[model samples]
Target chain A: MTVLEMRDVVKDYRLRNGLRSTRLRAVDEVSFTLEPGRTVALVGQSGSGKSTIAKLLMQLERPSSGEILVDGEPMPYRGARAAAYRKAVQMVFQDPFGSLNPYHTIGHHLARPVRLHHPAFSRRQVAERVLDLLRRVRLDPDFADRKPHELSGGQRQRVAIARALAPEPAILVADEPVSMLDVSIRLGVLNLLATLQREENLGVLYITHDLATARHFSDEIMVLYQGSVVEHGPADEVILNPQHEYTQLLADAAPAPERRLARHRQPTLAAREGGGQQPLG
Target chain B: METTTQGTTQGSAQSSPQGSTEAAAPSATAERRPVTRKRRLFPPMTLKLGVGLSIAGLIVLFGLIGPLVVGDPSTVRDIGLTGPGHGFLLGTTQTGQDIFAQLAYATRGSLIIGVVVGAITLLLSSFFGLVGAFVGGWVDEAFSLLTNIMLVIPGLPLVIVISSYVPNKSIWLVAAVLAITSWAGSARVLRGFTLSVRSRDYVLAARIGGEKRWRILLVEILPNLIPLLASQVVFAVIFAILGEAGLSFLGLGASGSFTWGTMLYFAQNGLSLRLGAWWWFAPPGLLIALFGAALSLINFSIDEIINPKLRSQTRAERNRWGMSREQRQAAAEVTV
Candidate 1:
């Protein structure tokens, strides 16, 4: 079991606009802990430092300040410890099309991580593991031989998920994994991730803009606005009783069928009066 | 529990679209499989490629086999400065040396230099280009600076100065000089390509997968560069061959070797052109032009692989345009 912790992480970017350089704080004093078998949905709009936080967790970018700890131990920068950290914390990138190497087969993608983490596994064992991974992600075993272009977007995402799971990581950082995929297939992919998280007891950081899925899929919801967490609580409480104005705006933006039905059935007296007086105003 | 049921229903709903895609995939793969298999057996051979390969192949075959079948190129004959006839297929040079034998030997020698220079250029360019870009920072700065310096220096003048400085010049030395001068251009191209490729998400994904740096560079990045590399190598070979010819024609060619350039130099010295002994000078010049054209054609075909937009119109497309006015009118009437 692994507990991934981000202690007051702040990420800044040096932006240069020809001769005058300015600092842009992408993430500001954000802190969170991801315990095994739990999901934390990071809900935010575009340019809200959602990806920066994910990059920090994945060690793709270094934090400007503060520390990241794995099981109460500081994250290693390089060497065997770093490799171990990577194996423990894997990520599923947002763009499946871009994430997969077009030159390689799906089997090659999955088999690589398995072979990296488990060097003792034989070639046959690796092949078996790749097929097993394909099956786990609801892909046909035949997909192992196919290049990424041959597969649909959803299938490719499944392959990406399978590749992430190949090392049997304790923490999976899904950085808007389904945002690039079709809406019809989004729930299926999320459900698969949820199922896999449950099966392996993986700590998941599900970064997304869709508040409905955020509330439904995660145990806790963190509403981020302009690189800062505006509200954080139990998923339903954060959605139902938003404490911050940004969170309230976000909650109101999400289309709710029941709310729409209620509004259609009965327009409030004030709303009716306002509708009647709209042209004069 | 309700969400799980909803998810299952959606999952099943998801399969309908997936099933349509799955239905489409098999036929797509079916069309793709034979094409891939055919490609494995033989790369897509355009008319230009076919002609280029055949010409190059014939020249290479002549170089390989013609030397063994012919007599000594330098042997002095009684029939001095004769035209094509009298038991001499390409006649005699001004000094009575068999022109055919000299041409054969020159082709072989020139080809040797081309191949050697191509290999060296491939090594140097890929090393400076790929390694620097992939490893970046000061190393990249140093390499880019070196490449820039090399690029700015005029190639032929530098080569002439280097060749003039080195006495007892051999074919290998000349090849090395040509390779050193030509590699910088391709290195710059490779560096630009490598920079673009190294930052691609697949490469980043490989790094996040705990893959070693070298493995990611070799496995993730290198394979994508094969078409570009192949085209660069071909261009290098053509440059090397042409550069050597130019050097040899200036009488600064390898002292002992009988390259096409050296043959031209000897013919020029003997006043073969003034005497109207076209066999001596013309064969080598024609061969050089033909070989260069052939290699250029091959390079163009390779370029099409790198950028598909360069490919010419297909037969059907051309045929559509080729229809006469009557045929066009008939086709229009049929459509109506």
Candidate 2:
């Protein structure tokens, strides 16, 4: 089984100030292990360094001073080593519409990865592989010919997932993949990710803002706040019994039915007694 | 904590987060996009394009075989028979040359200069524009500076100075002068286009896919600009043709050249207007205007075809077919 680990990864970016520059640590000693068939949720709100972490793992941005290792070896930066590493790690970006190349057909999108990773595969084999990948994502075989713009949001996201999976990467870094999608189709995508994770035994770094869905989906939850992992544990433990103040705040902010029910029940009870209002839950 | 301000900006936002493909990449509307060709010069062409192309086609026909039809105008015919219904057809000038023959030969040179200059301009602009945008930073700054300097220079005076070295018979020299002066404006426009296209998500995705930079620049970036580039080529050709005519008419372009410009030059020099040789000056000038009109028509039609939003009809259609969120959901349900 493959294991992807980031050992004390700290990515610091330098902001320009005319001639002088100051360092800003984006991912401060953030560390996590993604084992095969397991999902690790990087839970954080906007500007919480969740995306910076995603970028670091995707190798789109480099960590300042840490080791991102595949198996036991540190990830290489250039040449065949980098290309091989890229083949093993593929990202499903946020904004499915933006992720896909609008000018190309869905087939061209899938073919690119397959061709890149499996150079020996014939044109016929690549075509077959693309069709198979589309089917796995529950997309119609006919969709392979359509452009990104022709497809709906859910359909485009599925295509993006299919494109990511084409290279047969060991680890899937899905960066808030469902956030930009419609609420109706979001569950379908989440379920698809879950199914794929189980079937392919792919290590998934599922990044998101909603702890509620992250609880249902991720095997492990790491609550990121202000560039540090404030809380990290097994999914149910984090959700059911949170220790950190920020985590508790997130839980409180989450729209739970019980809280709404209690608030509703309080108003009626007070009206029946014809008394002053009680405190809200 | 100071952590709030620490990583507030990674400067990655300046780079693309997702590396999106377009600024306002609206959905490719389903209904009428097929009106644009999947292949260049392909069928399923719009009525406007067809009409414009027909007009252009006739002018192109004139350029190609017009001289062959009437033979050489310089092969001096009967003199002093200056009328519409004479055996000389469009009648003879004071120099006894056939006006019809002059017009035919002039079309060949004028159209040739236009096409050659346009092609040269396209090559120069695309070279400076695409590479500069893709390779950015200092290279981009240099190209920007070059374009700005070229744009600021007085084009007509520059053309005049350059073409002065040009011999009377060398139409190519005149074409080259026009090409040098005209490319900067188009290059700037193309640079903006390249800058926009280079930052697109697909380009970034290609980079992540480990696609070679050259391949991304050539296959991916260049093809997207072809429609707009095609329109630019037509505009450049029109500019070059008119520039040549204006220069030659001013007696600064290729002397004795069988272009419409030289024909007008000769007509003016020979005092054809004062000498009652209406057929002498009138045909060449009329042809120039007609050719200009034809090219402009083609340019507008190409614009209409490639960018459908430019058309009022498409806008009206979009309004008619456009849906709100609930309506889109309803439509989705119906389709399902």
Q: Which candidate should be chosen as best, given lDDT against the real structure?
A: 1
lDDT per prediction? 0.90, 0.84
Each candidate's iRMS in angstroms?
0.7, 1.6
* Worst window of 10 by summed lDDT in candidate 1 chain B: B34-43
lDDT of 1 by residue, A1-281 (tens): 88999999999999999999999999998999999999999999999999999989888899999899888998888888888889989899999999999888888999999999889999999999999999999999988988887788999999999999999999999999999999999999999999999999999999999999999999999989999988988999998888899998887788877776665555665486675432110
Task: Give the number of the best model, judged by DockQ.
Answer: 1
Model 1 ranges with Cα > 4 A deviation: A267-271, A275-281, B1-31, B37-43, B313-331, B334-336
Question: Which 10 successive residues of model 2 chain B have the least lDDT summed?
Answer: B17-26
Q: Model 2 clash pairs?
A: B19-B201, B20-B200, B20-B201, B21-B200, B21-B201
TM-score versus the correct structure, for each prediction: 0.91, 0.84
Q: Is the docking of candidate 1 incorrect, acceptable, medium or high quality?
A: medium
